[model samples]
Target: MTSTRLSVIDEIFLRTHRGYGVPIALQGVWRTTGTVSRDELVRIHDRLAVGKLGRRVGKPRIPGARLRWDLSPGSLPLECDTEAVENIVAWADAQADVPLDPQYGPGWRMTAARLAHGGTVVSLVCSHALADARGLIDAAAQSFSGSAVPEPISSPGSDAADALRMILTVLVRSIIATARLWVSARARAELRAFATSDSARTPPHRVRKMRSVVVDIDASQWDSAAEVAGGSANALFVSVVAATMAELGSPAVIVDIPFRTGSGDANSIGMATVNIRGDDSPAVVRAACKAAFAAPVGAPAGYPPEVVQLLPHRLAATLTSTPGRGEVLCSNIGEIPPALSTLGPHRSCGLATRAIHPAAIGPLPCATIRLSTYLSRMDGRYTLSLVSTDDALVESTEELTAAVHRALEKRNLAGTPW
Candidate 1:
């Protein structure tokens, strides 16, 4: 019965859903080392509704009309597939494209498939309206709900001053935003001209479909690579992306790194957005990641930045990129919750491989790389997914994956994890 107020940034996806065809769903894929059965799956679903794990409350009683989670049973569909792992993966991938409709009355979906290959694959598909890439993954963790409850601190008699400052900031930013709009066409033309030599600048072909390539790396080796880079495991993700883009011969690309709200509370999750330049060196990657890690969250309208999303989704996106924003979105959801037998009757050793199968409608930036890990770092391997609008960019995903491996291995930065 708890309803949360969403921020403008959170609504960016809402706008996108309303205007653009972008699939608003953020997807997380897990390969269970053990099989999950229908009965076991039922228990997990119940837990989700009861708020025993993950969601504070389940899906909204209804969708599209508003944002809410309905605790009713049979509300969330758990896709049951007794087929091969690929089948489960494919189904999970398609969940993002499930059109948003008021008739549906909610924006979340779930799938648990018992793999014929001796494991299980589970997916938590949610409307970007519910959470971002990182927030969505955190949503699957049992502890996510408890930590997500937000507490805002305020002082008495300070509202007036804060309100005035907000008014001024909004007025100034709005004016600038308006001016940019009038000249946006020219800006895009300039970008297009600059892109003539760099094919990566081109948006995906009218095929304007979304696609991803998940790259797996040994968990232990990944940790060592991070150590050598003098950064956390997440930094290594930034390094590979920056290195790949540099190899592509682009001058510079701004990587939008949206940091998740540690609590993963839906209301507070949309307030942070980080933009860092990507370049040729792992050192630069290390620096950018550090800055992002330290950057402060922004507020809009005396609240979280979700206000930015109030504008049309495409417009909201353009505001960031029209001038000189980087088109590549690279991020890593460091590690996900390990498999536990409590959630089911399976052996629950841990995950085999993980995939971030993000579903979107079209017109993607040059490219995107999303990384995630499952199980403990000791045995959890990283999953890297390359996303793009065009098939050409999709083709490069493999090359880039190979390139990162080569760079790490060649530097001897990648060694046994002890």
Candidate 2:
């Protein structure tokens, strides 16, 4: 018997056409309290790898044909010091001159980063355009026997938490479905704001420099809001961000909502990244999100082909709006496990995460707001990173944070992802 160099699914990565070259990095914070072992870490890596074990089709930007399905590499080190993590990210602002390899099935690369005191920071940066946010979290949960996996239709909420994970199988299926769905009238409607607006008709001004700042905020704010709004923590955070954009002058925004409904069908708890593009009206965006979560029970359908094929144009239009595009890009990676703190006994638990966008928006890209909550704690960490040549935006992280806080205070909760 010969050892399989790579799984059959892995070989398909080079053939995937959905711009599979995109890189997605998600960091898992595990406390060293119980003696974290390499075996445990590898197990987590393996589970996530298994989640991407399916066949492939056309070729994507990443090189190689035989290894295409997931294009994720096994966990590798981020190659920098604890303090360097911040610097490395800041440097990437001008250009992503950094080297990235997606041959791994999860495109899931790892960095066994060591903190100043002790312990390890396991970071997995995969592609967001390919995988959904929920799927990323599910991969982490499987490593530690987390409760949320997709199971049979035996019980309710099974869609979000059951564990039938034939990852690759569902991935290809979702892609095909999404492509087909996006190729219809719905896709046009979904992108109406971008396509119809005259302000979005022209090309955007060239970008001069791209600067980004990443900070960790407390999730307790989200928890309190979720409690009051009666919605999932993720939904509340997104609503808050949408509301903030509304106040900032852009009354329209597009948010990528991840879907994990396949889990209910005994499929792997993977994510289908969908655009719940809506006007930045706080009330409108909130109502849309709330409805998606409040749906009695049903997985959101994949985007059709029309939607997929026209996404670039839609994206370009959105970016072309106004003297400059919207001032905020908010992403809420809901409750990370408290164990994600990669520090030793001397350090308090902390989780570090980053979100990326395409490079088309000139030297300076989009401004981003990231929020993550923990199930065990009332607080959540909110990081605001803005990409721009604007001096005022670059200088004041506190101002952005304060604005976000106020937006959350007035968010309405009545929307749905569907």
Clashes of 2: 84
User: What's model 1's lDDT at 344?
Assistant: 55
Give each model a TM-score: 0.64, 0.49
Instruction: Give the C-alpha lDDT of model 1.
Output: 0.46
Query: Model 2: residues >4 Å from true position, as ranges?
Result: 1-106, 117-120, 144-221, 225-236, 242-285, 288-331, 337-348, 352-354, 357-418
Q: Candidates' lDDT values, in order?
A: 0.46, 0.37
| Candidate 1 wrongly placed segments (more than 4 Å) | 1-3, 50-76, 86-91, 100-104, 143-207, 246-252, 261-279, 291-324, 338-343, 347-380, 396-418
> What tens-digit string does per-residue lDDT give for candidate 1 at 75-164?
456667556765443455565555533224345666777666678777666666555554555445542223332223122223344345
Residue range 168-209, candidate 2, lDDT tens digits? 345576677558566776645545543444444222333333
